[model samples]
Target: MTTPTLYGYYRSSASWRVRIALAWKGIEYDLKPIDLVKLEQKTEEYRKLVPTQKVPAFVTKDGKILSQSQAIMEYLEEAYPERPMFPKGLYQKAEVREICQIIACDIHPIQNLGVLIRVAGSDLEKRAEWARTSITLGFKGLEGRLEACSEKYCVGNSITMADFFLASIVGNAKRWEVDMSEFPIITRINNTLSTLPEFQSADPFHQPDCPEELRKN
Candidate 1:
């Protein structure tokens, strides 16, 4: 089968989640960088490709198109189950999805680039503060949830989809300067996950589209 294609911005948290999942599953997909900072995703061509005009659009080998990071990651979990991203237990899987949704649906949207641009415009400080507040509020509940569910990872022991969401958002939290001290569980999990080769390969700073000054050597 031909490789899938992913269109994503380098710094997008949702895109990073998909990248981590793809890397963890050992899936070789073509990455077509959509530079959000350049307003590339707003182009008419891109709009036709993705009606929502969002990054992390995926085209499967069989010509199936997918959008939204959670949907795409779930697709990967089902299609390539060898290195499963979800737990076998139904309740554990639900908890995993709950954590992913808490980040994606509740926390991320308010602080995402699109929302930041609309809410704070060009004032970088305002944008940072808005993001920081949103993330801090979200992390409060998230930390409590992790305290209950986490062992070595976000769920029981093994790394799952929840870990991907956690790792991705922690990067964003740091970006907005949300003091991570209050979220010790999150900090520990993120630090642990950062050491994995899959997470390293999927890092925003390591992506081809990252700016030279920002790229990790």
Candidate 2:
């Protein structure tokens, strides 16, 4: 089978989640970095691949175009169920998806690149505040929900889609300086998940377009 193409920027949390899923599932893909800072996403060429011209768009080997990180993740889960993102049991699967939605819908969209750049305008401080407020509100509820099932991972002992979402969100939180020390459960879970090779390999800083000087170990 031919490898799919994943178009995304390194710093994009949405893109990062898809990367984690792909890596964990062991799917080989080609990266087509859509450098947002360079305004490459707005070009006519990129727009043709994705109507929304958004980062993290996936082109399947059969030439199908998939957009939206959460949708793409779910598609991959169903298509490539070998490394299943959800555990057995109906209720448990719903719980995992609930957590993923909390991050993807509630927290991520409000503070995403487009929204932040649009609302922040020229005010750097406001941008940080936007990120902090959005993440805090989302995390507070998420922390409560996670406490019931979280062990080494979000849903249970095994890694699920929730972990991928949480890891990506936490990465963005730290970058935005959200002071996540308050969410001990989130911090703890993220700390554990980050040490894994799948997580580490999908890290934003390790991607090709990540600036050399700005890269972190």
Best by TM-score: 1
Model 2: lDDT equals 0.92
TM-score of 1: 0.98
User: For all candidates, what are the clash counts?
Assistant: 0, 0
lDDT of 1 at 209: 95
Per-residue lDDT tens digits of candidate 2, residues 19-130?
Answer: 9999999999999999998999999998888889888999887879999998999999888989999999899999999999999898999898788889998698999999
> For candidate 1, which ten residues in a row score worst on lDDT?
77-86
- What is the alpha-carbon lDDT for the whole of candidate 1? 0.94
The parts of candidate 1 lying over 4 Å away from their true place are none
Off by over 4 Å in 2: none
Per-model TM-score, in order, reads: 0.98, 0.96
